[model samples]
Target chain A: MTENGFDTSCGASSGTRILVIEDEDTITEFLKTGLKYEGYQVTIAKDGVTGVDCAREMEPDLIILDIMLPDKDGFEVCRRIRRRDSDVPILMLTAKKEISDKVKGLDVGADDYLTKPFSFEELLARIRALLRRSGRAVDSTELRVVDIVLNTETREVYKGGKKVSLTPTEFSLLELFMRHPRRVFTRETLLNRIWGYDYAGDTNIVDVHISHLRDKIGDKPPCLIRTHYGVGYAFYPGEGK
Target chain B: MWKKLSLRTRLTILYAGLLALLLTILGVTFFIDTRNLLIENTASHIRATAKPIIEHWLYGENLSSQAIEGTKKKPDSKYLKKISRQLARDLTSRNVVAIVLDKNGKVIANGKVLEEEPAPVSPNPFYYRRAFSGENEVTYILSTDNKNVLVLLIPLRSAPGSDHVLGVVQLSSPLTPVERILYRHGLTLAVGTLITLILGTALGLLLISSALSELRHMIATCQSITEGRMDQRVHLPQRSDEVGQLAQAFNRMVERLEASFSAQRRFVASAAHELRTPLTALRGSLEVLMRGAQDDPATVAHLCHGMYREVLRLSKLCEELLDLAKLEISENVQKEKVVLKEFVNEFEEQARVLSQEREISILEGPSVSLKADPNMLKQILFDLLQNALQHTGRNGRIALGWKLGDNGVDIWVEDNGHGILAEDLPHIFEPFYQGKKVSECGEHHKGSGLGLTLVKAMVEAHGGSIEVRSEVNRGTTFLIKLPFE
Candidate 1:
């Protein structure tokens, strides 16, 4: 009810609201500060019953719900929110980093998930991406890194104006890496980001997708994605410094 | 049957038999020689008694040829009878029977014709011839009565230049007394031999049985050991014999076996417990997540996520457990020449991908080579790398490098993050041990605690060893020494 809605500073448009349903005041405050920094208006609901009421009243552009709540759990809150608003994006926050919890969140209509003790930067990024996918924010049609370009809406990719064929998994991985170029991403982080939080495979799935991305991008001077030994994978436009 | 007897018993019996055989031979020889000596002695006595009488007559110490002619008249015959009677009495006491034979071989003066008539000798001319030749003779024969006897003959001689021949005076003595003495000697030899044989056999059996008993006990103990009662021991009589020494050696061998078995059991039980604890924790966590707080989507999701992470941990634990077990059971790891540079590169790449949240680097020279099991070496590197990543916080740097050592390759994995505590470093390789320093890394950083344990197992399985050096808050370095082919 306060003016300027929660402490967002990125100048989001009116009606671009984020509902934060968390019982823990510390986590709520943290999320409130981080999401506000990323310029999304956030509303706090201390418990599941209040969280459901806030979701119905505000019809939030995005819902950041905590799994452990006082009255009703986040799953029920998410399910009830889905009953009224099927198109709104929901991001679930859970203390337990379990696949079954992720599946339950997904079953109750959460669009994405972030585990507790997570970095604020990652949480903000996931929220923005989910919002963008749900048409809650101004749609950025194309994502680009140097000569490589990916159009998320059209599901098309191009390398220096040449059309490149990529599997869905490869496109998602490239999109993730391209969104945060020059940042090192481990296979586990890449898996969680591109393959959803519930993916339970060899983690070699990320390697295979990266290999496929490299193949589609073609073998040439200064590969876009560079491998860091004993670290992770990173995207570099030219020779890595 | 001989195999049933111990070696000691067999040897003793052989020795005793040989001794008894020798003694029996000596006894038989002595008995035979003594009997012959008795017979010879009786013959000499007969000849000695007859020789003097014959000599006196021949030398003219008694009546000559005129006396012999007068013997045909009654008065002269009476005088001759008195002299002959006196000579007969002396001869009779000397065990000699004498008779005077005429030129026609008729008995003339027979002395001592008692109740029993003397057995006649066959009139073989051999005796007469022997007498005429004036040679005293001795012989041994079975007479017509079938009695073993010795005979002696002496000739009667008249005075010198006298053309008359005197009747033959023969001294005869029965050889029965000589036979009696020989029989007595034979009896003594037989009894002595029998006593000697009995004593020898008894002593031999006593000595042999004592040795055999010891041997039998040893054989029984050996049989019991072979029957799988390894605890059974030989109770040897406390003798300083060879058998006693052998029993002591056998007992020492069994003691060694018992110690080995006990050690093996302890190892197996410890390994089982290490594997079971993690699985039970994982299972309990999953059960809690499954049945509790289903209505709260957020709580369910959180619990499910926890369960999932636990499952991941459990899976990792299972993998490490299996790896450790394989290393423990595999006596010899298959070896191959590995290009160390390529292997390290591959390991670095994999570790980087797994630890992408951190800054890790590989620093090593190009293309080192070593002979080892490629899989085991990789496993060791993997475990060390994983352990480093788990302990290192975000943005921390880990360095992996290797160098050639004198006898093998020395590889090191080091991290600049929070290092292990000095107190816990020693027991880091112990299964399920999470160092106090490492425990503070974070919940996710807490591994199954089997990484270093598996690393140690793999390293040792490949006949190599791992060393750890750490300073609290400084960093940790793990050095692996792998021998070259």
Candidate 2:
């Protein structure tokens, strides 16, 4: 096994190799068609044991593991893989939407989980985000929209080349808005992205932190983060007057 | 058979029947005694007047002419005759017969015989023979014609010097007058008894019908309330009685039931609201990842991490919800003798395996024994351990230990991690409550805030209690108490 496990570090050159460990032939075929259409080398495994063996031998770039398998469960397979490797980035496919199942997957070292009947667009975006985080893909590392620049690596921000002081929380909030420029994000979405999964607290915490971030970023003619009425905040520099 | 009749009807019938029976006995006894007394008095008066007249005739025989002249001139015969007529009238009035018979059984005179057949001989005919033997006798009978009669026979004797025997002077009077009066009395008694029975029956029916109508109304009202229209109330008549009190009690019960139902509904809605927010984010994130992972391996890796974190949050929320449901239902937790020491060791081993990537070590203490539901205990420990692992930074050590407590057993999960703030400690077991320090953790490590809540619920389900002692930025210890066998 490679350093990141399953040889997922080849970036876009080695034709994104994906291992589909699914019990259902129809879902496996469907996934194969979609991945193949996007220039991926797709391999299918009918059960957990084969999936694990195939993963070890082939060292695929990614593993799409179904939670229900004939010989072994997805949780056990994920734990077995994590026992020898740390950074393989395993994506779990589960038919159950129960929170206990999701927790089990993560607790066993699976990188992520997806309930069944998912859209293709969502699967692709997640893959891009994972690849980007691992530094194995060519993507825009620094988020830049007009005069604003965000260094994801150093967790720093600059407006018009002037250093802006921000709390760790504020810096992350600014980066989230900059990553998806011109898209509206509600308070709940911002909380989830910055504060992690299911962090139940005062929702006004978002508003409070947003104001603090604005103060540190300094006053500009058109605000850096614009609030959409009764919705959420958005990042757009030039268009809004 | 008695159970079939209502208590009220049965009691009324018994009371009225006993009263009528007593009255009938009293009336019969009184009528008999009064008729006997009247007959005895009439016979004594006749004997007193006739005795003196016969005595004077027998002793003054030599001067009988002078005596007769004296009686005529002074008119004593008219007075005597008037007195005799009165004695005859008295016998007729009381429906009794007066007879005067001589020693030879000859009748001297009769009192208004009224052409009726001579009174039938008394069943005690010896009483008439005794009167002829010079002793007075009174006898009672029903004559051949069905008339009730009383007979008083008196013997008349001459003066000592006279040798000729005076013939028996017998007075026989019809007893129909007294019989007629008694018959009228009996008729009156029957009519009175019938009227009393009729009145009692009518009153009893009226009272029972009224009571039954009220009871039916109450039953109908109760049925309506049971059918889910709890707003309905029993309207008891304005009386200070048992039925009114029952209505009051029923109303109070309905009030309590309505309050509890409404409270339950509110709790469910609030719980839904708490769960919806996390689920939506998790769904949105996973959707983005599923679309196109093949084209870019780097993007696939990043999205996988995001989805993993979301799943963790969702699972935590779900566990909290399950625990809440169990608590609400008061599920009976199965109990067995558990080796506490061994159980803690197993839990620590599991925790160590999970946190292997994080550089955390879970330490255990010596074994202890306690009686509890093994499954519920494990769940409580699992939740506590997860909370510890999440809050603990890398290289932080968590310890699982237990000791024999006075009441039962105390299991502790102490972690050298960022503990809860004082303000947040009180609300740690409330669903969806996160502390102030949550902003410190990155998006992936932050929790769903339901872990401790689930732990508390699971512990309580096992008939145990849990307490947390923590110092912010230092460490926290969760103490669980379970009963010992």
Candidate 3:
């Protein structure tokens, strides 16, 4: 793990192009600098009008849009880009946490949303998630954290080379955890992701399944999934252990 | 300044003063008319009675010898008595007394005097001269007995054509009937005025009280509001008169005030919650770092990044708060005629930067023109477009277009992004409304939540309206109708 708790081995695509649409110069400079440090070719648009033009001309692999802009807004930019290209993932950034804003961003063809004051890790994770959803990511089909390994194509799990059986829901939950190892995910996010968008089921279902999976996986030798205590849970690779 | 007085009190006093004035004028006119009529009738009655008596006494055979003796202008009591008795027998009028006077103004006969103060035989010199000239004259005498008296004096001639003047005949009548009529009329007038004034006052008070009932209700409602019952309303009557209109106006004022107060309270509560969320995150990250996570460079970076984000959120919140205040105080919108085509073209140039990595297209719908505050109108467009951009993804399409209608211009921002949930539609424009979609997307921070609220206020200030249409996973459209006027 690198200093940022990121798996340095799983590098982004060598030529991954990311477009940033932001009005604030300071934020634009920071994003450009930060994204480049993570091995992404970053381009910046100062306003909404220029951003749309850049999206058409540059055809970047991914785009980060800001809700507020000097001329046109991020939503318009997303829509305009979508009109030209239908495959690039869009990640929305806003200073507002309003659900309407999120829904609006998503409605305009954005793949994900990240609010301001976001951690770089979260931003990177969301970007990766969007890219993976779009099938543009270079991520591997098989996910591994320590001895626990999950195969996405075969829907199979292995613990110390021993086969482990899991329900479809449990399998998806494990997949999400293994993919974003050491990253905290709340029960709500897990429910939304694994249980589907209309899931009205109890959140305790996650707890119930997690405990059951822990018991079956042999918690005595190495604890794979760690509880964040009052927050959520994270899958630790157990390097310290 | 007169508002210090109660409505009922002021109305009653005004009505009473007007009624008193009317009654006084009526009373004075009636009294003067009655007095003149009574005095004229008394004078005519006395003159009529005295004419025949004087003629009979002067031409009758028995009074001729007495008249010849009266040529000597000496008093002849025995003959005057005989003449007076004959005159009295000839004329049988009541309340009238006759007196015969010698040419020298001495009383010769006194008959049927009604009062103890016998008729003044020494006539007034001026009237005596009038009688001596053979002209009859009447005078009014207010006697010592409080009786109004009418006196008539006529000269006695020998045979109706004799130049020599004999004694004068004086007739006096008491005016008791006329005075009685006047007294009765006066009593009736006084009683009538008193009754009218009393009835008028009672009716005026009743009317004033009824009319001011609405005012009372308004006062009660205000008191309730002051006591913190913000929902209190005054139930108004159905009439559309001034009082009714006043009630309606008052009710509207109270409703506005109540809404304002509640909005203020909500703003405070929401702002506190918004500020607290970020503060809590900052505190949590700091506590984690303090608990030795700083030893691991990766954990330290993670914690510091989170703390920094929280601080940024706090600062942004402060800026938005100030923005909201400024928006509220910006009373007037600088209005201008905005050519829709030109405006869109201008906006297109500026907005291209906003869609840096997203596809945004502008559709020229109509060459519509609108009179609006240029800056505010631009802001409206920006907010709606920004909202659309926030929801859309890469490869999603957003269209900005305008439609000219009879009433106004319809400017719209439509996007094929993830639409809003049904539950969040109504409260989308509410300040500080953190919808569930935000958390569903796993977003950690939110804006001051004043964006949509500010947009709605700005649009309304321009006398325009904004509406939204959305379907889950389909798209969202923000339609703003800005009127030309």
Docking class of 2: incorrect
Residue A195 error, candidate 3, Å: 45
Candidate number with the higher TM-score (1 or 3): 3
- Candidate 1 lDDT, tens digit per residue, A98-208? 699999999989999976545554665687688777766753556655566678779999888999988888887777665545657767667656676557878677777
DockQ of each: 0.01, 0.04, 0.02
Question: Candidate 3: deviation at residue B203, Å?
Answer: 4.6
Query: B298, model 2: CA deviation in Å?
Result: 6.4
Tens-place lDDT per residue, model 3, A193-220, is 6775467989899899888878766755
Q: Which stretches of candidate 2 lie over 4 Å from their true place?
A: A1-241, B1-96, B100-227, B230-275, B286-304, B312-332, B338-371, B377-485
TM-score (0 to 1) of chain B for each candidate? 0.48, 0.46, 0.74
Taking all chains together, each candidate's TM-score versus the true structure is: 0.37, 0.37, 0.55
> Model 1 off-target regions past 4 Å?
A1-241, B1-26, B37-232, B240-242, B293-330, B333-485
